[model samples]
Target: MKHLRFYFDVISPFAWLAFAKLPKVIEGHSVTVDYQPVLFAGLLSHWGQKGPAEIEPKRAWTFRHVYWQAHRDGVPLQTPAQHPFNPLALLRLAMACAPEGMTPGRHACEKIFRHVWEGGGDANDPARLQALTQALAPGRDPNSDAVKQALKASTDQAIARGVFGVPTVELDGRLFWGVDALDMVSASLRGDPWFDGPDWSRAAVAPPGVVRPPKGNP
Candidate 1:
């Protein structure tokens, strides 16, 4: 079976928007997706990069772009007043629902995605997250023992993967960095260009390095 690896963080609006179409994309090509929750802060730290606070303009532009892209994808989304610093709890909740047997997991993820991206809800808020989860899984209460167990399992799985960012899709030991690259993932599942390098990196023969005359070439 085709496996599409997905990496994401709850705080990433772009990731939230991309999650909306994952199911549809997978079904379109009859493949399965493996979700990988990551820590955005940790990743940035590793890169020695100060967070978005260091670049307010860039952050604003990113949020705006995410909204526009979400619109293009027909996925409704909005920016939150503040992003959750840690979303492992939410990721665990998502993990519990993503497996084949529990269709509820998928529904729960969608609900949370909407809560974060559309309603501007804080994913780190247990009350809000649990509320959304309950709304989506009427039969299995988010506060139930079963759900707790599932959430724990999901969290464990995520930690095991060394996830440290949002929207990191991996396959064959290679990581695809963002939601915008889903088209490539979809193509892989379709048995086309599965191993081909990313579209952005494909080099069109860098027009033979040109050498100019010393000074006055008119």
Candidate 2:
């Protein structure tokens, strides 16, 4: 089994940031990264959660925060022209490229992310999508029934496995969400003695309040 399963949506700047940082995170480790594409809209619908882009300060903060992190990580940052465009075609294209090899899928993903997020391009444009698929997957067709079905199945599998957001890393039945979790992913890959750490519950103390909080919730 692959040590790291990364789920992403090209619509997410955080996912792009995480994807950019993955090369460094996986370096010097034997862990493998299995990149899987899922629709952010679908996950939000299934989990009854709102996307960051649909909210106020979060939507505004999302872009600013990720750009800061991208600069910090020496990764280029670009915003998309549309806030929440349909990703169906894009997801299918990525899955189509996947059959050829990881590189094709990965490069396709990077190109899409760069063009949409970095170049502020409209991802919903069919001509733009076809050009990417042609270059990345050769004869692959993104709008094909087969590609659409495959992406949907893969996305459903991600949702069933408790994936609720982009840039989620699944390992050993545990899920790590966001770029911040990459450190934990690395630690797990290295078999660190304190990877899971000790249960602090035994040495915990209650915090002041109208009513005391739960053991690890205070």
Candidate 3:
């Protein structure tokens, strides 16, 4: 059996999009998707990651690329608010639902992702997160005792792992960042050529300090 560690910030639209498709993509593998909820900005600061919107050329191309991908996948692609609040509460609720195991974890994460991106609901809004929580677990509000306790546990685990970002997949002692890396994660699971070392992994390599090629220069 193989383990796939997934660290993601729920507020990321790209993460939401990736999460939506991941289940199907990994259906054939004997893998466990471990969800690690973390702070996106913190992770970015640590790894020096910048959102496409932060760079003009990157932002323009990314908009078209994301929309086209979403369209191809038949998923809605919305321009989420700049710095769409942190996903802390959202992570807490997901943790609450998964106290025992991932059966509930996947379900919980799915609901949260849908509410935030698909439904365009405000996850940072206490009322909204609570309402959605109630919808999933009868009479259990996000602010309730049960939810709060579970959230604490999840947060503790995150701190232990030194996690602070979304769509961060940890495997083989390596951390793969971003939703776009899912393919590589999947390929690694299947012992694909790239994971074996040439095709997939090296294709994404950039010269040191290349900075994503300043967008259009690629």
| TM-score between model 1 and native | 0.66
Cα lDDT tens digits, model 3, 102-142, are 32467777777777776444557768866887877733445
lDDT tens per residue, model 2, 1-218: 34678899888888888898888877886666688888888898998789987888898888788888988988887676787787777777677776643323466778777767766777777688767766675445667776677777777998999998888988877788998888877777777755455632333456656875655894
Each prediction's TM-score versus the true structure: 0.66, 0.83, 0.70
Please report the TM-score between candidate 3 and the true structure.
0.70
**True-vs-predicted CA distance for residue 51, candidate 1, Å:** 3.6
Query: lDDT of all predictions, in order shown?
Result: 0.62, 0.77, 0.67
Q: Between prediction 1 and prediction 2, which has the larger lDDT?
A: 2
Candidate 3 off by > 4 Å:
48-61, 79-83, 100-104, 138-165, 193-218
Candidate 2 Cα errors over 4 Å, as ranges = 100-104, 196-218
Winner on TM-score between 2 and 3 is 2
Q: How good is model 2 by TM-score?
A: 0.83
Q: Please give the RMSD to the true structure for each candidate, in Å.
A: 8.7, 5.5, 6.0
lDDT of 1 at 131: 75
Which candidate has the top score in TM-score?
Answer: 2
Q: Residue-wise lDDT of candidate 1 within 1-218, one digit each (tens)?
A: 65566766677877886788677667756556655554566576654566654588877788778778877888877666565356655655665555433433445666666766776656567688667656654554444566556655544444456544567666655555568777766666676763665653455356768866755675
Displacement of residue 44 (Cα, Å) in model 3 is: 2.1
